[model samples]
Target: MQHAKLKRSLTVFPIVLFGLAYMAPTTVFSTYGVVAQITKGMVPAAYIIALMGMLFTAYSYGQMVKAYPVAGSAYTYTQKAFNSHIGFVVGWVILLDYLFLPMINGLLVSIYLNAYFPSVPFSIWLFAFLALITIVNVIGVKIAANVNVLLIACQFLIIIIFAFLSIKGLLHGMGSGTLFMSSPFVNGDIPISLVLAGSSILCLSFLGFDSVTTFSEETINPKKNIPKAIFLVALIGGGLFVLISYLSHLVYPNFQSFKDPDSAALEIAVYIGGNLFQSVFLAGYITGGLASGLASHASVSRLLYAMGRDGVLPKNIFGYIHPKFRTPTYNIILVSIFTLSALFVDLVTASSFINFGALVAFTFVNLSVISHYFIREKQRDGINTIKYLVLPLIGAGFTIWLWTNLDSKALFLGLGWLAIGMIMLLSITKMFRKQPPELSIDHAEVNEMQA
Candidate 1:
């Protein structure tokens, strides 16, 4: 029996919308208070720095997708650029980012819902979101993409309304005496160290753009469209983050005034537009979280399918795609099961689990570019040295810097996860006597190119 592959039905626009959904355009609001407290009102600057760092990494991803356009993303790139053993480990590490992020979003949605319906248990909301998102993913990627577009539109509408209200509030003497001020970008007294620390957390808001590469196999003209989608997602998402944060900061110049930093964005909403608009804002926030969960679920299932096909995981399950829907049914179910953990974990802990894995994957992706072009190819493709070397070096440096600033608990948990992956690698390689298995993609590539 022949197995169906993921269909290449997605274009640049739908995939870009998918990327924004995965990033959850409204996440900046959820994280704004924490970032504001850290940056001392320089939230925009922190995002600006984080955006620059992610763009460099995005460039590296663009280069890699051109060479190996597959669903494995960082896993496939690292393996082809380096070795299978290292690739296995990279795939294992990124599972933290892929598998757990939807759960984090679920937890966030539950919290928002519980705020309104105080009597309903959080577990009910969590499971409801998981079930809905899982079903959408299992149905088809194109359908999921359509759902994302609708949900993201709602989120963007809410953001635009909030921006207008914030501007009006500022004009009415709600802020630092004028609509324009340098405090949101910088302050003469605030230390640069504080802003860098804030950027570390804000970087989480930028995580979803890289996941766009996971759709490479299911994208039309993967080589060209995948790169364009990746860049557009980063630029557009980062611009939204910076603009919203700047406006929020203008309306409430003093970060110390927040009663609870975690829910500061909601407080800003109430201040700007009163109770009715607060309800609208919450609707947008919940919609953004759901959209994010749906996109993340789809991306993670594809990653698992890639690993399963390579025999890195149990091929019977994770590798299997539905003959009718052409989707990874088993992997989608598996991720849905994992998301149940959201009922037990709080938002902070769940959110912390992802940053370590993401930073590690990004750091290596940048290095992979250097290894492929600078060391292995010796710039033989006539690729500019600056493109292969200088830019990626800067990207690597910034990601590593952010990695160091991760909270202690995140570092410990991430290291523990890596240790488990190392043991699994040893067992899979049969004590290092044989190479880890990999799927043969030469035939598929030839067919795709010919078509």
Candidate 2:
């Protein structure tokens, strides 16, 4: 089932768009609202700082991807940097995170659906959204990418429209302020603790960029294009988010009133454009969320195919690729089934089930970056070492700090989910009588690489 490389159909631009599309507008805009509250109005500044932090880690990822472009992104990087065991753990944690991301997006879409049609049950909305996308994912990757390209274009247009409207509103005194309300960079009694807290939350909106590497096998020019797409996606996505966060402050200066994390941006849209534009805004947001769900579905399915091909998972079940399409049809369907089931769980649990896995994944990702550098210092010397080692250490430390600050229920639930994933891993290993091997790609010893 394994191949030498991804098909040459997918270009860098489309894949980068996929990453950006994964961070849905509602997710991005609402995240800005939450960060606005936490930072006490230093919303954009916080994003800028976080962008700097993310850039350091991104550089390391860029190098890693360039050296070894493979489907199991973090798994390959961690294994190459550290060892197979740690790499397997990284792959496991990332898979756990990716599997639930679709459900999170679906549940979130349902929340927005409620605002539009109060009579519709959120559970129904969740299931319908999950099912539709799951089917699309199972159909094939090219079809899935085509869908994503359209969705990304739509979402990008919406954001552009939003920026135009918000800027016009600010210029015409329709908004609360022009420049930031306070000395945003200087002193506003902004707590360091709060910024740290908000940055962690903001990290969620930026999580999907790394998932691009899951397409390594499908990308046209894997080595050059993969790294290019990742850096550009992160750069563009992170930059736009910062701009939107700044724009959000102009539209909704009173961030204190936005205690409700979920609907914060919707409230801003309502306030900024009134009822007429709110409808349009919400429509765009829903589209963005759906796009995000679809992207998550596609990426995770590829990860499953990669794992299965390596004999770590149920090879027969997951390794079945469609000969005509060259797509992992069975893996996609299996992931869809799980995600669809998760839709129900998310609706009932209110989606706390999603964030915990993501946090755990982020924690390990940061740790992987740090450990990879320390282990490969001689090979990865100079600024690259500091960029890899130091930045990831900060990211990891900050993530842990935020993890501690999460609500008690979240903490408990996250731990419980981790335990469950561990159990699942144990069961799978025992069933197969073989553990997932560590991922490694020595640049010096490399021939052609495949996902």
Candidate 3:
């Protein structure tokens, strides 16, 4: 049977904007204190290290997207580059990243909202935002992309205003001497181990860029645009993260000064701009969370659709696309159901579980580049050895190192999730007697023709 294909309507600009929205530029504030505590006020250094590490993986993603422009992101790339079983397992691991993201974003939205409206229950805001994000995604990716443009614009505006306020406050309150302190970048006294440890958490801010790969099928000239979008998202998002952390560090140099580490950014906002700007800051922050939730919900639905269409999951439901909206309606609703868990889960626990799956998928994407170029193709197709081999090796190594440094809770939860995926894989492949199911490029071409 033929299936409807996603509309190839997104351009490089919209996709990059969507990626930025998914990364949520204002997130540095939400987790600022935690990273500050870990790095001993060297948050910018942690972001710089994390950005460098992610760039290697981003290059791998760009190469793979050129080779296989499909909807599954890492899952499709890995499966095509390697084998069906490994791809199936990677798809499961990616589920941990894509599926739980909306939940984490929703929890963040609720946390920030609850802080402002102390009387209202958190569950109300959680479900409300989830429902809104679900509806927007179900309508269409184009609409979601458009919404992201506006939301991201607001976020950037708020960030610019905040930066100005922060600099002004710093000069007036702490003098010009404090403006260029090395404490935010490094303190010769702090151990390298602490900076690396902080990077493990800061890496979370960079998670959404790879989600751009999932939009390959929907993006115009995806072979060129997708890779560009991936690199731009990583570089732009990373630069913003480092800058914001540096400015924030200048505003509050003492890492141990926050009464509540999680909400320290909010306190800093009030200190810089007073109560009025604090309200504006909260509005912009909440908008960032909304943008993140919307993009994540859309990504997970597309991923499930890709998996379902490949027969890795039940195709009848997940593989169904809306004729009117040109979207995976059922999968969108399914992600909404998963997001309701945010009502019960706190931000820390929900946030901790995501890093493992992301790191695993990132490591494999690097390996996928190596497997495709070096192992199978054997002809780097005129591509340099550095692009195909050395870079990916470094990327894999860096991600592996970060994976090993995951929080103890994250490590346990990630392993448990992987164990469950293994069991499911056994059932699907019939205990290794049969190959795991997949959709071929030829089959996808036929479906596109039919559509």
Candidate 4:
């Protein structure tokens, strides 16, 4: 049986752009800034090392996505390559991860807005941002892609400007060379352990690379462009992050770091560009948020809609496509409700707790890629698979190492989400089992047909 391929509305550039813009520079910048402060300038080296480690895993994903271009991303790949239980878990975790992404963006927007407006309620900013993104997303995917491209341009422009200014400043004796003089092998005040823990926060900024794979079904050339886009997203995102971390230390080397990851970028903004610069940054920040929020909503809505068409989730709620718009209307509305609620709650308590979920999901994705490709390779008959096996294992190991090194708070949050997802999955499975066998098979067949 053959399934019709999805039309490619996304290009490599938009995929890369969305990855970079999804959580914005602040997500990684703020989260990892503490690590930099702790390392007392060694943060750049850490980023470089982390990037190197991630590349091997990135290749595995690139290859996997090419072989299996599906809407569910890792969920689909892992399930097909492995087992249904593993696939179910992957889908559950990734869905949870996706659900929390908008909240993180919303929280960051609220925080940044407060710095500028000071008097406005965080909830107001949060909802306003959400509403804006929702409207933009409802228009069409092309507009969202264009907005992502523009947002990416704005962010890259800022990063380039900052990198050059910082490098020039350093060369002219205006900034710190302390990290350059320091040895990577030696322990610093931030403590190697703390730095590793801090790296977990910063590492998420490095994620979204594989998010391109989620849209593989909609890509024009999934095999070539999806792989290329995955690699490009990781390479570009990693390089820019490393550059920014290095330049930030050189421009304003700080011994004491800000405790809150949420405020990290604001500190850098104040230090690097000052009040005037902050205004410009405010524009970039808001733009990035809108871009990311819209992209996430669109992508995840499609994911839900796909699942709905599968009967894994309630089909009625998500399967309603707008005839005029040809869009997943119910899924969009459902996502909007949850997103707005998260925004309101996050505004009150500043709960960007979703980052933890995202990182954990990322770690699993890397691990799953490694498991399916690396571990499974040697078991196959007479296939020359040394590169496949080693690279993937290393990637998996790196993911585990990073996951283990996460701060207790991060671990707690991640585990909590996972547990909740597990319970949800169990309920979902039980419900599915309770359905008549004929109906279950029929629905499953329908999903297969749609796929």
Model 3 over residues 1-451: C-alpha lDDT tens digits? 9999789999989888878876778877767787788788889998998898899999999989888877656767788898889987876876787678888888877877876777988898887898799888877644445666787788889899999998988878742326787767767899988888788877788977877877888889999999899999999999999999999888877769876676678778887899999899998888778766776677677767877887877999989999998888999898999888887665555656787888888999999999998888785655567779889999999998877777777789789889997897899889989997763322233233223
Residue pairs that clash (backbone atoms under 3 angstroms), model 4: none
Residue-level error in angstroms, candidate 3, position 106? 2.0
Which 10-residue window of candidate 2 scores lowest in summed lDDT? Answer: 442-451
Q: For residues 1-451, write the lDDT of model 1, one tens digit per residue.
A: 9999898899999888878876777888877887788788899998998898898888899988887787646667788889989987876787888778778888778877776666998888888898898888777745444665677788878988999999988888887647787767867898988888778777788876877877888899999999899889999999999989988988888889987676678888888899999899988888778766776677677767777887878999988999998888998898999889876765555656787888888888999988898889888444568888888889999999988777667789889999998888899899777787653322233122222
TM-score of candidate 2 against the unseen true structure:
0.75
Candidate 1 vs candidate 2: the lDDT winner is 1
Q: In angstroms, how far off is 443's CA in candidate 4?
A: 22
- Which parts of model 2 are misplaced by more than 4 Å? 1-26, 34-42, 69-72, 134-145, 183-187, 212-229, 256-261, 298-377, 380-388, 391-404, 421-451
lDDT against true structure, model 2: 0.64
lDDT of each: 0.80, 0.64, 0.80, 0.62
Tens digits of per-residue lDDT for model 4, 279-363: 7777887777766667667767776777777676688887778887777877777787777655444321222244454444455
Instruction: Write one digit per residue (lDDT tens) for candidate 2, span 1-451.
Output: 8667436678898888677765554457745555676678776776666566555455556666655666645556666666655555555655556677776777667777775677997778877896788667665534355765676677777678777778888888866758545545445477776676566556666666776776776787788888788778778878888788778777767778864545677777777777777788788788777766776677677666666676666778776788876767887677767766644452313233444455555556566666655665543567866666776777666556655655456567667656665666666567546665532322111112111
State the RMSD for candidate 3: 4.9
TM-score of every model?
0.82, 0.75, 0.83, 0.76
Error of 2 at 118 (Å): 2.7
Root-mean-square deviation per candidate: 5.1, 5.8, 4.9, 5.7
Clashing pairs for model 2 are 6-217, 84-438
Q: After the best TM-score superposition of candidate 3, give how far the Cα of residue 81 lies from its true spot, in angstroms.
A: 1.4
Collision count for each candidate, in order: 0, 2, 0, 0
Model 4, which residues run further than 4 Å from truth? 1-32, 37-42, 66-72, 135-145, 177-186, 212-229, 255-261, 316-337, 340-385, 407-410, 424-451
What lDDT score goes with residue 345 in model 1? 64
CA shift at 62, candidate 2, in angstroms?
Answer: 1.8
